[model samples]
Target: MPQITMSAPMSKFSSFNVHDDFVYKNVDGVAIKTAILVPKSLKPGKKAPVLVHMHGGGFMTGNRLFEPWFALWFMQWAESVGAVIVSPDHRLLPESSSEDMADDIVDFWSWVHTDLSAEVSRVTSGATQVDLENIAVGGESAGQYSFRAQLSITNHEIGGFLSVLSALTCPNAKIKAVVCQYGPLDYEVPWFTQPNHQRSIMGAPPAEPGKPEAVIQDYLTRYVDVEKIAVRTESRVEELWPLCVAYAHAGKLAEALGRSDKVMPMRLIEKAESLPPIWFVHGSGDTIVNPDCTMNFVNKVKKLLPQTPMHVSMEPGEHGFDGGVPLDEKWVQDGLSQTAAMSSKPGEQFEVRQTSTTEDYTPDPSKSLPLSPERQALVDDILALYSCQPTIRRVERYTADCVYDDQFVYANDRYKMAGQWFALPKFFKESKNERYEIIKNDRDLIQFKNEQSWTFKLIPKTATINAIVSLSLDPDTVDSDFIQVKYHKDQANDKDYSHNGFGFQFKKFQADNVVKLMSSDEVKYFEKDKHAAKEPVKKYGTGDETGQAPKQDF
Candidate 1:
């Protein structure tokens, strides 16, 4: 593979203002420094989201200024969002032990909460303030010598990033999202512990054509006498990049990085409490770290915390595949679409530059309001009621005598409302609130327009309903709660339209299906007898059966 050389990040983002060499922490007399890049479009006093990026240098070299290793799409996305970029230069390996690097990560979080705002304010000349609420941590591969190090691919970043999740002492520092590209995050995988014959760097022959194990031993012997060499100049760092891959090829990577349990994030992942939305991109053809690392990490995260939204973008190319490309590629645009989907949450939007493939959605700016805590909770509950969230409780949100009429099913009380609502999943596998607009919210009435879809469980067809609703508050509890929907009239939005054949048909079909699926037997979760023999779940494919059945049956 040919070397992908990229232009300076400053030149690409020319409109961005910069501040170089700001010290964030002092560790054992070493002043850990960081570089800040502020977008010019960010106006004065306006809040800006932050992107904390850790540079990739195999945990052995490269400062935070190593822009070539940065992902092209992510940087451009950050620029489009007017994000303040903070790239820290942490302690490198051989110079610092695994514990030291982990400490640096812990300290980095503390610095982010206490001093990051003022530091950014000074950097951008008070043009923008850091929005601590909306923060993302991202890094390119710096793990595995072949370009799979994540925190970017090396043990330093893997340990460091995990340290933030598992060992972080700071309460105020929270990361809303994470973006990792081509990382070997799992140390227990055979790739890190087992030796490999292919000593090539991204399919290129090694500098020394000898056996990988011999080459690794030779390199280890040379560095054995050297004490810690923390920070190096740029050119030297570049030279050291390819050289680090030898240890990984010979299966000495973990041992070389002090062989500490801290380097293994697989051990730490289960301990993470607050999981953030993670975005992972890997080159399918990557010879260094390989895509399995990313897939494994994503699978583990999903298994541990399935609710955390994750997007794994796989492109065709070698490691650093997106080094010199622009942000318009299909993979990049797909990532942008995922970001757009994430924007539905109130303050967790990372709206990036979109390509032509993505559909534009322009919500009415007039309706946007800063809701109070109670009203926000009401909105959340209302959205949850429609979104088919697993955790929704109808009794907690709706009034005892609330009326719900969708033409097919009618309920005059919260008890019946829950029965009809819970019956939704029996007909459809998924129910989603596609587009919602609150028409009115007051003491007497609360009204909204909702466009939603229900996907059939057995068929491939999907039904979209254009529903308009008006809510009447209960007089007794309305003042105390401010949102007790005593009556909810689900009106059809398309009935009055001049030509609504398409819309009316969808509503009719979905409503009819709901009525068909509403029998208590189909939705047995709300009512099931413990003594009754369980219904046998139908198997889709032909299979052998071994489980027991009661002998009383005829």
Candidate 2:
């Protein structure tokens, strides 16, 4: 019922033609989409630069057009810079985790490069075009981490997202500038970890008789397990705001994001070799997310990219104070100017180009190492098994008594294997990238790697199964050479991510010691072998965050 269709809250940008629900990609069969605003002046042949923005809903709830939190200045920037606007809705939390968000980011940028142009042209009847080569990213409150900042609260708090972006190998597209609204950038600070009884912007923290912690559990059960895309997530702030307040009140904002050392995200400032131009907007009177979030992040980023344009639009207001300010206001004009300047001359060394020469690239499964028809057929069947394709029954992929084992899943016989595979849909939304890089090929042996993405329906998050698998075929059974999957003396695993190969066995042992310290009663409740219960390995924040009960600042 919570659909994020376009609503024109800002009247100034009415000149631009808007298109909603451009399906960029699909995750777990759910369509992840973006809302686009193309300037009417953007001619069909002449490419216009692009700006992709993330919306803010305190992270707990808000759709893409959650107009209440829209950064009004984004419109000015689009007009001044002559950029087409693309706003996307990503998986949101208390129900979702930082790991799922990371995938969304990767897939988003991947979509921007591969499919954005065609989508734009199709929507506009080829009257509008997007310049992926010239691009910028910005976001408000929860959106800040989507662009820059150490994400902490309701919280599009994309904890340590910049590090992920920096590691990506996207050479074709250039990240021109970063616009950050009043984002809760530093989660490591006390303001984030401590309870704020006083109202800042969102609303007054929940008063007594409201057990937010308990309410969180009820809402978790009441709401959709995981709203894959933000807009599709029907968010009634009235109902969910308590969970946001409670999360902060209990100093559990850190817990909601999982444990990550990067909540502060200053490591990026210390090690980043080169960064694009950045701008900041924060109100001095801000309380919910202290002004320090912007000042601290800007200060650190300024030090890292001192020559780069590190513009700030500081003023006197609270979080999201300028959402509806008129464009004629001096402060509003000043803020808009700062962003426009960044968009124009993005960096001291960066070149401002309206076009790009690099060819667009999208992932191709067929581009992997080539194999003869027989070898390829064997590889295809093996992948079907990895993806747990139910229709692979007649494919003769796995033996009836195949030894399939994993940390949380155990399926040896075909019956148990089928049950485990079938239960996957029940427990998690499954998506697979069958891209494989064959490592070895022989008369009876084949090895390759496959990464399977899972969004757990119950736990409401994601996990990637990167299984480097090797299958041995009985040379004597030439007919089933490719179809035969056998257990090797040391190469068989039911675990998607190998404990033996990836050094998780040590962590498992360490976890075992901690489990040993727990009382019998506590141990009884913890499910050691349920994939739903297992913590994802890559979720952001410091794992060292200690758990505690509520401590109201009131």
Candidate 3:
């Protein structure tokens, strides 16, 4: 990514001055750039509320800077609410997974109010004073999930990112309000089955093997290298971008099934007691992200938490309706006034309006199970492989084979001999640093992560893969017994995205100690400072050459 620069305190509009990359904060070993907008009418030394907006791009593309449309919208919002607006350039996928991005957002939130408020005031030379107590967080599309994550599971420590700031640091600190615009709150909803829907919860097309291009199906489960696995796009996403996206949603789905600590806002409808007042805006004609997702979430919140101030407004338009529609200053001012009145008081009035009911919908469970615990577990485990910190370190680093299922059926059965599958594994053993324990069974989750590292071997080289499973499991799967596992890998060279993960199941399972499951040679390999013996690269032949590849039925 190129460095984006802008003049400090430059006037972008008549009502406010914009400052880009005000103070870069290190989040999860990655620096997060933030932009601040201060209203021109605000007097120095007088504290004003702040609105933090998380930009949306399906977690694949987007930034914090204001676009042309956002500029006018921000100008109106600031003038109406009498607040300063801050946007953080949260990290994106392929390089940083959703879990990593969530960590950055949480850290950004904690730092802004807990650490950067004073700096912000001093840097502006007291021109703008931020009222940390009245901070509000909002987002659209993928960005909305970040707010949901923070609200529902912020107190729980999940990954290494928690080392800097635990969600419990300021338990009493609460978000004043939220603005959700056309967000995808439910993954299991039939909203994806609509005629114009571009993507399902699993993700958009080209994710399915052979949908547009013929690919080695198992590769989707094994490794994430786009060089080894080709997508239909010519973009910069060389690493397994699609898998990263699918896995992130999977983790949320698992959390929704009550099988993980990850938070999915729609799943927390019954636990809306702690949520802040919210104003939801959606387009009745929007098909990009089902407007019904937001409605469903709001309706559930209204039913479960009647005291929580809530409002919903729908217009006749498509996704990103605001971008095309010109903003009316009077309407924005009135809306903000109503928001303020409702914030100070509770449930004064609720609003819901729409031009058409054609797009209004509720998901049907007959088409699919509302939630699949097994698939969710697989996704949660994959995410953990990328985000979880090791509880114990037995060595500095090592490359070893940790296999999941040797005879793993590829659902598509692309290969005749299933035992020939393999993936590369590089383990970086680091010392335990912080006391971050958000999930009680996180150790078990980590164990699954280790096993997922093994499943990466099953993928075929230079082939894209996609897998969607419908099997469900008990939410109490955390206590399931472990099974024997083996691993095979080439030498390690600090490669992180080399291992892609897949979902698999063992028919006969039994519990075994970690020490007993790992061979002494493998443990010795971990302790070795020098590179271990180089394993000969395995040769793979096409179906025409060896007649081992499964026939393409589709």
lDDT of each: 0.56, 0.51, 0.38
**Model 2 regions lying over 4 Å from their true place:** 1-13, 41-44, 141-173, 198-206, 221-234, 261-264, 335-554
Judged by whole-model lDDT over C-alpha atoms, candidate 2 comes out at: 0.51
TM-scores of all predicted structures? 0.58, 0.52, 0.45
Candidate 1 stretches with Cα past 4 Å from truth are 1-10, 141-172, 206-235, 339-554
The true-versus-predicted C-alpha distance at residue 283 of model 1, in Å, is 0.8
lDDT, candidate 2, 206-313, per-residue tens: 445436556666766665455442323326545555566676665566667665443334554566666666667677876566777667777776776675656677
* Top model number, lDDT: 1
Q: Which is better, 1 or 3, measured by TM-score?
A: 1
Model 3 spans > 4 angstroms off:
1-15, 22-29, 66-71, 140-171, 192-223, 226-261, 324-334, 346-554
Cα lDDT over the full model 3: 0.38
Each prediction's Cα RMSD?
Answer: 16.1, 26.3, 30.0
Model 1: per-residue lDDT, tens digit, 65-167?
Answer: 6555556665666665667888777676654666776667777777888899998877666767888877777766232333433213332233224323322
Least accurate 10 contiguous residues by lDDT in model 2: 346-355
* TM-score between candidate 2 and the true structure: 0.52
Predicted structure 2: clash tally? 14
